[model samples]
Target: MDVSIIETSSLGDRSYLISAGAVGVVVDPQRDIDRVLALARDRGVRITHVLETHIHNDYVTGGLELARTVGAEYVVPAGDDVGYQRRAVGDGDLIDASPILLQVMHTPGHTHHHVSYVLRESNGGIRGVFTGGSMLFGTTGRTDLLGKEHTEELTHAQYHSVRRLAVELPADTKVYPTHGFGSFCAATPASGDSSTVGEQRTTNPALTQDEQSYVDELIAGLSEYPAYYAHMGVINTRGPAPVDLSLPAPVDPDELRRRIEDGEWVVDLRERTAFAAGHLGGTLGFELSDSFVTYLGWLYQWGAPLTLIGENEDQVADARRELVRIGIDDLAGAAVGEIHTLVAGTELRSYRVADFAALSEALREKDTTVLDVRQRNEYAESHIDGAINIPLHELADHLGTLPDGEIWVHCASGYRASIAASMIDRPGRTTVLINDDYDNANDTDITSAT
Candidate 1:
């Protein structure tokens, strides 16, 4: 049996395509089914089942649509109260897939109905297990997504679930998880690219620490995830609309400006430095990069009209795919061209981009208002001595509270800083984008710890 990993690095999740001879099974597919389809086609395998470990809180699942398209059984954990049809499965249920058998094991933690599938050859030899959010590489999935009331209960459950897997499964059995590659669904930052049950026994917190210690650390470590995560679980459980990846309608310069004036989300998808150099007034500089979708979705008002201004059609198309993966479909329109042309007769907005060394020099000369837009935990761990902490997610509401003068904005990386600086730059305020990695700032005299 061969297990293929389909990684969606943007969301820090993985989908599995397990194949044996001509039979194939897909586990936790993303919204874009074409990728999964192509993989199965290339492997020359017939998909017989599509399995979802839980109702995902990070991205829309393609399992239902993929199963419907291929005429395969759609398997969901029993008791999720889903809106669509699926073969609701429970612990110990064995699914026959010819060359391999999938043994379901109920592992509630990530969600109330989460389950893992143990892959076994038809002859009953174990291959590996798809543990979804239950058992990640070195940590477990976050338990607080449901609500504050359920956090403690779920944290305890998560501990027992990982312990159960460690005890029941073979030490050398390969472990595959859907979240924790960088997904906010993880309780903490997961370690390594790959791991086995045996490796986890020595490294995973659930195995090394006692239940109380693990629960305490996990609950305390839980941090804020994307605000868009609230919509993902609902979309997945109620059956997400089929993904439409086709480019949004072409918006002219006039329409783009009108939307921007109307306070709609007209995001510019260029490199941060280029965006800082010149961009349309009132347009958000959400440079097209790995971290773009996560922050954009977090700050975007759900169901609001969103427009994109990209350097070219390909950039807009790339941004659209990333948006759809997180259930941000139905774009208002997009304008693609040089920034100058897109601005029409209006003058483009610009900001200063500099490094930490420049910030250090400026700080030494006089008092400067520094804005650190990283998360609260990140700000607490270490930061510039006198910097203000308004995390990027909460910056919009706190803009008026910032001290007057030229505000210098920064994050761990320059991405969030660029977004914050663009938001801060207006007719009345002077903003500087500290476009450098935060670690480099440690070399200067301004570094401090709380």
Candidate 2:
């Protein structure tokens, strides 16, 4: 069996293409279907089936559309109420794709309708398991995505679901999970991406702890996720629109200014250093990278018209791809060129990028309020003494509560702090960004509140 792992780095999500003989199956595909289709073409195999572990709550799935494009069967969980035609698969059902045999196993933990597909060899020997959002490298999927009420119940179910895989499958059976690779869906940060059933039995926290202890630990470790996640579940249930990879229409300076005046978001997708040096007034600085989707989706208003500001067309295209994954398709336009030309004499906003030593000096010299924009769990683990914890997601709402003085913003790295700095920095408000590595926090004379 030839198995290919297609990783979407921005979301840390993985999709698999398993081929046997002349036929193949795609599992947990992203909205962009061309990549998966290209894999099949490269392998000289026809796509026979497109499988979804569940209605994904992170990014839009390309399963239904990919199935239609290739004339393949779209398979989903039996209990999912996805409003579209699909081959509803149930537990203990067997599917044949020529040389690869898939057995469906119901693992209701991440979601009540979640399932794991186990691959068997020609002689019915267990080969590998696609454990989407159920069993990850060192941890399991976060149970709180559904809601606070369902957290404990799902965590309890997750314990048994992981055990079921361990007891039923061979120790050498490989495990491929959809979440855990830098995704917020993971209960804890994974050690790596791929692990075997035997390795998980010994190393996975979910399998090592008792049921209640596991539930408690999982719940306690949960932190704030992207607000855009709320729209994903509903979008998946109702069927997402087909993805359009066409570049957004380019807007000139006047047009961009008009949209901004009309209350549309003008997001600048540049590095934090470039953004901090100089940027258009009121423009949000979100660096185009892996965490781009997560933080942009979290802070951006849903359904609001948006205009992207980037260094060039390619940067704008990259930013667009990331946004489209989370269903933020209301891209009004894009502005690409030199920053000065885009702004055109408008007073550029700038913030001071400080190192740990500079931050300590600033704190001592003035009444500077150190604002840590990391997640709650991160803040709870360790933070600078007397630092105010307002996660980046909640910053917009808590702006009024900021202390009346110089605000020093920071995250583990400067990515999130740059975002916060742009949002909070205005004419009168002086915001200094601690843009250095937070690991160097221990090197400073500042006390850490552990």
Candidate 3:
């Protein structure tokens, strides 16, 4: 029997393949089927079992596609609501594969329905456990994602779930968690791609915290979530399965422009701050700082031809990679040259911002509209009076509500304001950037973007 850990960092995901007796099992594979396929083909092994620890939210999984290609059994928890073929395995259920044994563990916290699998070598009897998002090396699941009604109950449940794994599972059991460093799944890693149960018991910080404090801290620290979380679970539960991934041809700017003019939805893949500044009128804006790839799949329709306006040419490839992860394949290419030319025919104008004193004077004169694009905490901490707060993270959805007047955007620094200023696309709406960290300047303008 042989075990291999596939580091699928491209999608910012990690999965494992266990092979024995001519049959291999793949756990939580990423959207790139070719990588998984190539690895199996090279090893002269065929995938016969596809195990999804849970319905993932961070990125789409290639589990179903890989299963279809290999004629494997796709398995998930009965509680797992997903759109593809899957056999539900509950706690204590086991699958035998000559030299490998897998036992299912129900660990719900990251989502209402999630699972982990404990695997063992037939000869040694027990070797390791595959913990999906529910349990990472040293951290535990964040209970805030569950609906507000279940928040308290789930938080307590998560505490017990961690307790169960830490107390009941064998100390010698090697741990293979779903994600590692840089993944949103877990912040702290005790050691290695794997850990021993005993080691985690003594070292994992999550386990050391008393149940209540652990829950509060974890929930409180969660960043402003992606703009698309609520609809994702439902979509994954019943939406049409993701289409096959075949990289789209690179589109020329002229072709992209034609598509834009032809009524296809154009996406501005810069950060919210950038998009709010000034961009092609009517383009859907999502900043690269947020979860652009995941929300790209959620907010936009699939099969929709996508034209992009990014910070640079290099980001075009990065944007494409993320869109492809969830099977969104249509491309109309990127915005080239000064974006102003594209909006020249439209009324979307650009405005700039200066220091609070300058902004105050402008407010008195009523020359421009001020947009505060900082977090709620930052906005409450200290901000310019009379400035309307529409956090940069929520800019995409809330932009429609703002008055389409001369729009001046500002964040903590000039960098964010420059990005925020780009979202103004109406011919009449002039967008401007404010150097919020200004040491001397009183105001800044959209032209400040370089």
Candidate 4:
């Protein structure tokens, strides 16, 4: 059997085309269906089945679309949580199609209907399994995805699901999880992909942690998942909308900046961890680790020219390609040199956040106001008190409430606070960003006598 991993960077999801002789089974078909179809057309192979490991929350799924295009059977997890699929396959059920045999395993930790597929080896032995978001490279999927309800129960369920597979599957069964390292699905993810059952047993931290520890640690590490998850979940539930393969040309930098100044939306796509360390102020930060394409489509005001704050030149092409994948072709050229364009105008000065002493002095006046732009949960867990909690996604909504004072912002990692600090619109309000790691964080920032 020939298995090809199709990297659909549209929303940082992976799909597979497993071909045994002439039959093909596409797993977790992401939004970019045309690419997969083109691959099949080029190879002259016919796709017989389209399988979805689960109802994805990150991006739209192309399972139904691929099935429609190829007239293949659309298979989803057993519970029929997704009502549109052509068929539902339960745990331990096997589908024998000529040389291809797929055994479905119901892995419900990621979602109630999430399933993993075990493909038959060339010698008819079960060797590889596609573990979707249920189990990533290093950590497991977030239980809060479905929200606060049943989070603990699902975490418990997830633990058992992983343990069962660890013990039941052969030590050599290769694991292909959907989102690999660098994905926001889990923090502290494995360094690389393609791990074996034996390797996971020996090295995976999740396998050893107690159930409570597993839930707490995993929950703590997850950064804010993109605000676009709801829309993507709906799209995945119904199946993906068609994505036009042809993209528009990249825009010029000058044009892009003008748009940003004219009240247009622009998102900086650098790593959140890096952006928090330091960045140009006033830019709405969209860390690349979050779904760039997904958020680029939703939060992106239609017809607004986009200014990309790329990590580096190598990421420029990827940034452009991702924008195009979501029908956003009007990219106002990326920031020319560094992140300075975010605060390019006259009178808006940049001050580096060094230590608590400097920050305390900055906030010593009656007119100093500190802003916190982390998720609601993160803010509650222990954030600098007296800081207004305007989560980044809701920044625009709560902008009216920000006092016209020296606005100093900070996040756990600093990336978001930089984005938050940059977006403060009040004039004469000196902007500052604390380091993402907060090396100089003063306990007084949270507990000081106000």
Counted clashes in each candidate structure:
0, 0, 41, 7
lDDT by residue (tens digit), candidate 1, 16-110: 99998999999999999999999999999999999999999999899989999999999999998989999999999988888779999999999
Provide the overall lDDT of each model, using Cα atoms, as 2-decimal numbers: 0.92, 0.88, 0.66, 0.68
Model 3 vs truth, CA RMSD? 6.5
Name the lDDT value of residue 64 in candidate 2: 82
- Candidate 4: lDDT of 15? 83
Worst 10 residues of 2 by lDDT: 342-351
Top candidate when judged by lDDT against the true structure: 1
Candidate 4: regions farther than 4 A off:
8-12, 38-44, 81-85, 187-191, 210-224, 245-291, 294-391, 401-418, 432-450
In terms of lDDT, model 3 sits at: 0.66
Question: Between candidates 1 and 4, which one is better according to lDDT?
Answer: 1
Clashes of 1: 0
Give each model a TM-score. Answer: 0.99, 0.97, 0.71, 0.70
User: Candidate 1 — which residues are off by over 4 angstroms?
Assistant: none
- Candidate 4 has its poorest 10 consecutive residues by lDDT at 342-351
Report the Cα lDDT for residue 79, model 3: 77
Two-way TM-score contest, 1 vs 3, winner: 1
Better structure of 2 and 4 per lDDT: 2
Q: Write the per-residue lDDT of candidate 2 for residues 287-393, one digit (tens) a residue.
A: 99888888899888888888999899999988888887888887888999888888755777788888888888877887678999998878877888889999898
In the predicted model 4, the residue pairs found to clash are: 252-333, 276-414, 276-415, 281-422, 282-422, 413-436, 414-436
Q: Is candidate 3 or candidate 4 better by lDDT?
A: 4
- lDDT tens per residue, model 3, 1-450: 676877755334578888876778888887667777888877777888888887776666778778887888888888765556688898888876555679888887766667788887766567778887766777765566656788677767777776778887889988887765445555333345567878878766557888778778766666554434454455456733545443345545556556766868777766554455555655666666434664455446556667777656667666766666655565755664456655645544334445555665576686567787767766765656567888765776886798976766777766555545655555667665665573332353321221
